[model samples]
Target: MYASLVRSTVALAALCVAYPIQTQASDPAHESHHGKLGTVHFEVACNEAAQREFNLAMAYYHSFVMEQMKAPLERTLQADGSCGMAHWATALASLDNPFGWPGNVSAKTLADGAELMERARKTGLKTQRERDLVDALAVFFKDTEKLNHAARAKALEAALQDVAARYPDDSEATILYSLVLSANFNPADKQYGNQLKAAKQLEAVFAKEPDHPGVTHYLIHSYDYPPLAAHGLEAARRYSKIAPAAAHAQHMPSHIFTRVGAWAESVASNTASANADGGKTWNSPHAYDYMVYAYLQMGQDRAAHLVRDGALSNPTPPDHFAAAFSYASMPARLALERGDWAAAAKLPLTPAAGAYPWAKYPQAEANNAYARALGAAALRDAEGVSAELARLQALRDRATELKLGYWVEQIGIQTDVVRGFSAARSGDVKAGIAALQAAAAREDASEKHAVTPGPLLPAREVLAKVLLDSGDAAGALREFEAVLSKEPNRLRGMAGAALAAERRDDAAKARDYTGKIARQTARADGGVDGTQLARLSVTR
Candidate 1:
C-alpha cells in the first residue's frame, strides 16, 4: 500500500511541475485570492468560477487554516452547488486539527460533519479520484456516535491508505495520507516509525512540489520530535516563505525552532505570526507563548515580560484550549524560567473573566499549581508547597475523571516534580533525588504533547539543579549534559553545566559552556545574571 502511494505521489508531483498551477486569480477583487497559501492542482468537476474558489479553499485547507478555508469553500458552493468535492473539502475542514483531543470536538460538530459527507455523496462525484477522496473522509464522520475519536481516526487512516494506493497520481490524496499517518503517530513509540514513514512520503512529494504548503507544513510536524528535529530545518525555513500570508505558516516553523533550541529564529517566526491578522484570538496567545519562551532562553527577560503582559491584558482572548494553554503557561514560564520563585508562587490560578475558559482545560490550570509548588519548594516554604501539591493532585484527579489522557499523565508528572522538590527542601535529600530521577526517566521516555512548547521546567533540568545544590557536582554535570544533548543550546542547561564544571575545578569546560551562552545571548536585553553565568566572564 505504501509503495503504491509513493509511486502515485511521485507521478502527481511530476504533473504539477510540468504543468504549474496558478494559485491566485489576476483580479484583485476576487475572493479566491486569500493569500499565498501555496499551490495545489485539484481539478474539480465545477464551473470555472467554482474551480478557482475551490482551489483557493484547497490552499487554505492544505495549510490547516480551516476558518479561512470556510469562506472560500462556501463561495465555491455558491458558484456551483453541484461541486461534490467542495462538500468533501468542507467536511474535511470541519475535522479541524486532526490531532486535537477528541473532547474538544463537540457532538454538534460531528453531526454537522456527517451531514456534509452525506451532501457530498448526494452530488455523485464526477471523477473516480473525487469519489475516492469523499469516501475516505466519510469514514471519519461515519458512526460518529458509535465510534470513539481514536477508533474513527484509525478507520480514517486505513481509508486514506486505500485511497492513496488507488489514486497513485493524486498528489492531494498522497499528501493527506501522509498527514493522517502523522496525526496517528503514537507519542510513546520511541522508534518514531509512523512519523518517519510519513516523512518519507512527504519528502518524496516535496522533491516535486517544493512550493506545496501542506508538504512543507506536515513535514515539520512529522519531524517535531527532539530526535528528528534537525531533519526538518529545511521545511521549517521554507514553509513561512512559501505560505507567507498564512499566520499559522508563520507560527508553524517555531515548532521546529523550539525543538532545536533555535531561540532567535523562534522569536522571529512567532513575532511575525503574532503580528498577522490571526493575532486577535487563539494564534496571538499561541505565538506569544513561543515568543516568551524564546525570549527567556536568550536572556531577554524584559522582552519576554512585554510579550506575556501584552497577551494577558487582551480583554477578550478566545476561549479555546490552545489560547488557554498559552495564556496560562506564559506567566508561569516567565516566573519559573527567571527563577522568580515568589512571582511563580503568586501567579493567578485562573485568568481574569473573558480571557478564557480555564475550567474547561485542567492542564492549563495545573500550570499555575505546578509553578507555585516548585516556587514554594525553592523558597523552602513547606506549607505553601504542600498546599500547591494538593492542588496539583486534585487537578490530576479531575483530569483523570474527565478522561483527558494526556493531561492526566502530565499532571502526574508535575505532581512528582513537586514532591521531589519538597522532599529535597525538607532535607530528605535521598528520597527527593529518587523521586526526581523517576520523574526525569518518565519524562525522557515520552515525547512532549503538541499543545506545549515544552514543560515549564524539564524534569531532568530540575533534577540537575537539585543535584548541584546537594553538592553532587558530577551527577549534576551528567544530567545537565544529558539535557543539552537533546535540547541543544538551552540556556539553563548550559548555565547549570557551567556551574557544575566550575565547582569541579574544570575551568576549561566551564569556559566552553559560558562562551556558548555569551554568543547565544549577545543580543539579550539583560536577564543573565552573574550567578547564572557562574562568575565566569562570558567574554573570556
Candidate 2:
C-alpha cells in the first residue's frame, strides 16, 4: 500500500513537471513583471524600485499587441536610462514584426534601433540571462553587412530556444520562442508543421495561464491559416477582453472569425478594434478593412458603405505599415468585392505615404491593376484590358527581381486572370476559359494571407461565372463546387452553384443549394436583394 502511494505520487510529480505552473518568487505586488504570473523580470538592468516601469514596457513588447511600442519603451527609459534591458527591449520592439510582413520600421527607426542596441551592450548587463539576451540580439543588429534579416531571425530563434531551455519556469521566454517559431514559417506552405509545433507549446502554456497576453496573441497567429483557423476561435474570442486597450488585440480575433465565415463576430471584433484606440492608431485601418469585408459578406451593404465612406473621408491618413496596408487595400477591396466597375476604373494610381517602401511591390500594386482589368473587361475596352495585362506582367518581373517569390507567383496568377478576362471580352472565349482554368489551379494551390478579404473574390468563383456566361453549365458547376469546398456556405459560391445546377436541369441539386443560400441569408440582419437573387436565377 505504501509502494502504491509512492507510485501515485511519482506519477503526479511527472505530470507536474510536464506542465509547470508559473509561481510568484516573492511578493507579487513588488515584482518586476508583466503577464498573469508576474514572471517577467527586468532586474537585469535596474534596481527593484524602477523595475515596475520596465515591466510595463516588457509586458507590451512581449505580447506584440500594440501598434507601436516606442512610447512605452521611451517611458521605461525615462524611468531608468541605465537599464540596459530597456534599451534591448526597445530594439526588439522596433524589429520588423514577426510573420515576415511589413511593419512601421522606417529607415530612421532602423538606424535608431541599431544605435539603441549598441547602447544596451555598452551599459553592461548584470545577469547572465540579460547578457545572453543582448548577445542574441547582437546577432541581428551588430553585423547587418554580413547577416541578412533571414539569417538574423534564424539566429535569434536559436538563441531564444536556448533561453527557454535554460529557464523552464520562464513562461515569457517559452511564449516568445513559440512566436518566433510560428512567424518564421513559410506562409505558403500547406503542411503547417511548424505552426502546429508552436500551437502545442502555446496551448500548454495557455492551459495554465489563460490571461497571458503572449499566449493568447501567439495562439491566434498559430491558427491563422484557413485549415487551422477554427481552432483559434476561443483565443480570438478571449484576446480582446484580455488586452482591451490594444487596438491590434481587438483586431486579431477577427482573423479566425473571417476564416470561419462568422460575419457577425468578425464585424463586432473589428468594430471594437477600430475604436479601441480612438481609431487613430495604425491598427485601426486594419480593423476598418476587416469590418468592411465582414459587413459585405453578411449582405450588409449599407454598413459596408458607411465603413468605406468614413475611411475615404477621414482627413488623417495612416503613415505606419499596418495602416498603410489598410489604406492601399481598402478602396481596392471596395471596388473589386462589389463588382463596381466604374469605381474600379477610376481608382487612384498614386499610393499613400504610409505604404512607402512596399507600395511599389506587386502584391500591394496588384489590387489597382486588378480593379482596372475587371473594369475594362466589363466595359469591353480591349485596349484598356491590354494595358492592364502588360502592367501585371511588369509587376511580376519586378517581384521576381526583388526575390519576393510569393508575390511573383501571385502576380503571375493575376496576369493569367486578367488575360483571361481580356480574351473573353475580346470574343476569344476558348482562350479566356483556358487562361482562367490555369489561374484557378494556381490560386487553389496557394493559401490566402490573413490580412486581406478573400482574394478580391476567389479565382474559381470568377472562373465559374465566366464559364456560365459561355454556356458551359457543367464546367461552371465544377469550378463553383471547387470554391464551395474551400469556402463552405459562401454566398457567391452557393449562388453560382445553384445557377449552374439550374442550367444543367438538376432541379433537386438546384433546390438544395438555393435552400441553403436562402436559409443562410435569412439569418443575416438584412437579407440579400430579391433582384440580385433573380439575376442569378435563384429566385426567393
> Which consecutive 10 residues in model 1 have the weakest lDDT in total?
13-22
CA shift at 156, candidate 1, in angstroms? 1.0
What lDDT would candidate 2 get against the real structure?
A: 0.69
- Candidate 2, residue 327: how far the Cα is off, in Å: 2.8
lDDT of 2 by residue, 309-403 (tens): 66655566555555555656777766666667777776775344353554445566776787788778867887888888888788778767655
Residue 302 lDDT, candidate 2, scale 0-100: 52
lDDT of 1 by residue, 123-167 (tens): 758888788888888888788658877788889999999989997
Q: Candidate 2: where is the Cα deviation over 4 Å?
A: 1-45, 62-68, 100-111, 349-362, 394-403, 523-540
Q: Candidate 1's C-alpha lDDT?
A: 0.80
How many residue pairs collide in each prediction? 1, 0
